[model samples]
Target: MRPVRLSVVTAAAAVTALAAVTGCAEKGDAKGGHGAIAVTAKDDSCEVSAEEFPAGHVQLDIENKGSKVTEVYILFPDDRIVTERENIGPGTRASLTAEVKAGDYAIVCKPGMTGDGIRRQVKATGGTVAKRSPEMDEAVAEYRTYVQQQADETLPKVKVFTDAVRAGDIEAAKKAYADSRIGWERTEPVAESFGDIDPKVDLREDGVADLEPGQEWSGWHRLEKALWQDGKLGPEATAFADTLDKDLADWVKRVGTAEITPTSMANGAKELLDEVATGKVTGEEERYSHTDLVDFKANVEGAQKSYELLKPVAVKNDAALVAELDKQFAALNALLDKYRADKSTYVFTSYDKVAEPQRKELSDGVNALAEPLSKLAATVVK
Candidate 1:
């Protein structure tokens, strides 16, 4: 969707608060449960006190008192750095624990929020540091291999659906389209690595439809007619196609460029959930401009394309998969109607400005669909 647009004020506030917190301390006595450093953010900067930390492992407690979201990063002498939890919203704190060696290091808040929070330099002395063992290295390597295998298996299935469509076999096209939903579901855990692109919104709920009995299917037929037959695609239709292409390209690109590790996806998912939380909490109607709606629509379409790509894999294995997908499709349509009604009735100024609980309910409902839909991807392509 349209990149999340934060006001300059909000951005500055978050950055400043983060900076202040990171600068606070180097080491502190183990408190509560572990060796911990407490840092607090105020305004746009964070305040960190200096301290001596145990060398083997350390924990950082980041407390935010501002009105924006913030992230923390730790920089080391050898250019090795660790990004702490991100999108820590207002009034919340996150603790990050890591094993660190004795060395000079810097801590800073991420940019884009109050420019960048403060930075503090610290030196760890005295204790023995843990070194990576061969076993750990081997585990990491094995995980990488597994991710590559998954991607390799997924891409070809996606290609099958697209190739079928390109061949213009209406029946094969429909079956292939239905089959491709598995591809997206299969790669979702991997796909989550891509930042800000929500698979639930971008791939699960939108795209070209199967030649089946439904309004969604008919919508796809109408689009094809307008594009290939009439040779006159509307702005909306053109935009939808573009998103479909982009979503596919993104998946393929990740196969080579992305790390495909669980950590990558987990980190991305945290950021996404944070953004969704921020959007839900702020209730800023102005944030959902016309451009935002257009982006939202594109994301919905991307999710649809992903469904189309994996549908064949799903239907080939279980007819029930199609039924479930159709159910979600219908649910999304109903949600859209609710949003429209709320907008027309001035229920909360705008769709984005709906009550926090309502917004969260909507986001959670959509996200829940991803789990079952994702299971189809694990089934081998038939």
Candidate 2:
């Protein structure tokens, strides 16, 4: 995670090692680039100092000349918004770096930090020079493919939920609901990038930072209200489910292109644990269904997937720390798994079923997982 202190956490190579395992590493090692790419942001245009450059560890030095806040994106032809630095206030400079391969990509500057702004083409001509191993590269690729699969998997489950609602089967809809959200919650960050569609599909009713006043609330929460609070799946409820299903399908189609860095993935795992601690443990999510356990378990699965993919890289960097991370993750998952009552019955079906002691256990488990997962980002991301 980008901490309270920035600039100080330079992805310095870890100095420590696990005895008889991955050997020792040197500390104070510099990460990522030898030179910075100069970029200037103006009212409606973007200027890249170098139209052509070597492909490798490069930082974009963005100087905002615009009166408004600006952001820059390096967009690849494959639809990945590979890297970005956001909220560069007027007359200020901000930097973001990315490891890139030799390829052509579009550079976009978003002034006012709103719509996609001026775009220009840029090319990379040389080999990559980042200090990353093939093990790390292979892991990231596998993780990316897994994320894409999660998107694909979530869509069909959305249909199951929608179909149950459309059939006016409240019990069936309720059953399908929790299962449908697992894959969605796992790959949530990708869905969140889709602007209008994210709020439409999964935004909790209370989470309204970007919500426009007077806008009607819809999506899972909307259906949640009908199924749980209203205790019936009526025409309006079915219609809303249909809407959510469509949006979910759209997200499944669009999400494969999302940019997910190792740092973001590590941070995302920790954030999911935070979500579990703050919301799931408190009975905040699944307000009606009380199926918080399902979401909680799914979140752990997501976080675990993220960690496993980066496990080799982390072990190579700091073996003992990664071992701790692995142990904590296993503990949390084990605790959740212990509560299962067959395929249909997950750990605690409802928050009300959990005794005070059990709730504390869940909360403590999340905290243990969170601590190490949070540190994983700094250990690996440069």
Most accurate candidate by lDDT: 2
Candidate 2, after superposition: displacement of residue 376 in Å? 0.7
lDDT of 1 by residue, 1-382 (tens): 1122111111111110010111121233323235367766555666565555656556577776677776666644322223344555677666655455565666665433433346666666667644434533443355455446655665565466445455544445444432343333334433443432332123211222311224231222333343334544345554444454555666566545443222223232233323333332343211322112222222333344445444544466678867786687557446545655453421222454455686666666555544344344323122
lDDT for model 1, please.
0.43
Q: How big is the RMSD of model 2? A: 10.0
The TM-score values for the models, in the order shown, are 0.39, 0.66
Q: Spell out the clash pairs found in candidate 2.
A: 339-347
Report the C-alpha displacement of residue 173, candidate 2, in angstroms: 0.7
Off by over 4 Å in 1: 1-34, 51-55, 74-81, 101-106, 110-139, 150-382
